[model samples]
Target: MRYAQVYFLFLVSLGMVGCETTPKVDNPVLGPPPPRLKSALKQQKLKHAEIASRANDRKNILEGDFEDSENPFETPVITASTTSAESAVEDTEDILSDSTVVAMVNGTPLFVSDVIGVYNFQLKQAEQRMPPEEYQKLRRALVKRDLKGHVERQLLIHEMKSTLKKEQLDQLQEVLETAFEEERIPELQKGLGVNSPQEVEAKLNEQGRSLYSERELFLKQQSAIQFMAVKAKATSKFSREEVLARYKANIKDYEVPSKVRWQRIRITYAKHGGKDQAVGLLDEVIHKLQAGEEFGVLAKKYSDGTRAEKNGQWGWTRRGSLAEPEIEEALFTLPIGQTSQVFETSTSFQIVKVNDRKEAGHIPFADVQGKLEQSMINEARMKATKEILEELHAKAVIETMFDLDEDDVNSTNSAGP
Candidate 1:
């Protein structure tokens, strides 16, 4: 039962996983468990038989849907190096006091301190390149999120295993391990230039030493995705109203920026002789403007820019956009119906005639409906994921003796570099 309990704990701890936007790498932000938890955890005393009994009793004890026990002080099987029970008990008490108990599934406790340990470790790693404040906040938020994800996955796995055939679970585990080792591990190793088993082992040990987090976060994330997909298929389906409601709720994200149209003529100093030829060309362009020749027509004939095809029309100019600073400054300054003298640049001599200008503004909603609707759908998917996790947390069986304050438990402090 103690081995079973330990195994269950291992599985539960493994269930918490971070988002998988990229490759599976060890997180440097999570350090080893606080010395107290590590020591007490090492000193676990409960027998394998007791834990086995608990696992068997789960069906009978947690009968109702969404039911969970409130007390978390259930005795754990400790296996510390020490033989003195008194020393182990004292160590456990100290660990519980400083630690934060978050949620308990069945009689197992999930400590806030444990989550923070991982979060801080990740934050420290990010701080190598990012500003301390920015990375810390990001790490803290991600840690809490991943912790919730972990707990929900544990509950889901327990429920699933209750019905899964022994052969089926074994087969799935084998497949998962093989996929990770044969496909993911090799790919990651190759990318990192770790060509040998010795090199891979050395790298993992080195990273684990500095960060104190196991490489298991990657496996947990993959497992969670699989479990979620199963749950979604068996439970509920997406609907139109849900989509529309989400779209409406986040409508502001859809607006577009206004644009302006204008025309210009450029004479390159590189093409003509130098300052003298540029000046002569500018004078001729000014003379053409006085003669009432069309600016676009002259630009099409003499302008050195690719925009000459559009009759020197730069389709739209948005404020603070990506145009050349000199061009932008000169364009915004020229009055309508005025022609400018030669503006010398390292590349060209330019004469700009302002045909017209339009002040920038927001784009109307109707004009951007398609983009807005897509954005809404993405937001809805994220919200749906969150709602599912919240639901799982609400119904989970949990217990804990960690003495963290409520504020500390809920606080979102930056983890610091």
Candidate 2:
């Protein structure tokens, strides 16, 4: 049988034979078995024969033999003891082989080995930290993710080949190869802490990569990037009116809250023995401030607040953000460069100085025009890139080992640069 047919038969046999068992009667008088018992025995026999045949076919397939013999339905008589261990080994070898295709893009195959080779270092790390079952699950997820990326890259390359002239592609390839050798190699050596080309190759080998593969990958990425750059530039230009419209649509993002930068002196009741002592300490601090001594210096010398070590400097705080309502009110109401009169909260005696203040308002368009324009251009470029990929996906023939619904296909196509 063909491999797929054998697999289907094996599944059907398992469902029939594995689940059914012969039943015993209380006062049985049996010469031959009952009709139901006979049927069950026959099915059990067929299941074993099918399993043995499938195993033999699997062995042949692994050895690259697909030709039919004189008797195509012939089943090799397999001894249970010998075939069990041998079949297990063949099954494992089949799974581990590199020739299995996981996906195809425009008829170009992506093999199991390709996914494993590209991400071997990451897989090794995950294997070290996870149990065998968990590691297997993670490996499947990583392979799926890698296959999507590989398919997209293949699609892009296909688009480039179809759209670009052969002469232009040849010239671009030459330029990119020259750049890789002259510029990228030296930078790569420095980044990898290697001094020579051979050393760089050795380092990459340890990570399941090689110099040739690295260069090929770099070329592919740069080709796609350059192509996308040209396409995006053609579509990305935005008028001043468009930028202004985008900014107005997102105007709430530009509103700045009222805030103040202030300093404080706090004398907690617990730190100063009692409320009376705390009040007395605050009076001394006030006297020093009144005599032209610096508030920060007075705070450092006497305050028991958490920021005392930093001269009790409270950095710019937005309005109504403080837990203490009394302190919050005092911070915003105080004039710039002036200290508030001493006030008492339930836990402490406090004084504050406002260093600066900004009223609640929107940032003016003139101040952010250049940034807004650049941001709008970048957004347009991204949208253009997405559209290009979507168009390519619609045109290309994509097949994968796993099934994808429409939503999944759309999501894969819409993945950003």
lDDT of each: 0.53, 0.68
Q: What's model 1's TM-score?
A: 0.43
What are the per-residue Cα lDDT tens digits for candidate 2 across 41-122? 3444455556655776567666553344578556443333345534544433223224556665665666767766677777
The alpha-carbon root-mean-square deviation between model 1 and the true structure, to one decimal in Å, is 18.5
Q: Give a tens-digit lDDT track for model 1, residues 1-417.
A: 212332343354334422332223342222222233333343443332344345434643454233234657533333222224445344333222114444454334555554555444344577687754465456545544656545556656654454344554665566556556566667657855888655766766554321123335445545566555444433233355655565567666544454445777888877787767777777787788789998888899888879898888776676568356766665667776666656667777777766666654545545656665565555666666656554444443433223223432231111212
Reference-based lDDT, residue 317, model 1: 74
TM-score of 2: 0.72
The best candidate in terms of lDDT: 2
- For every model shown, what is its TM-score relative to the native structure? 0.43, 0.72
Global CA lDDT of candidate 1, please?
0.53
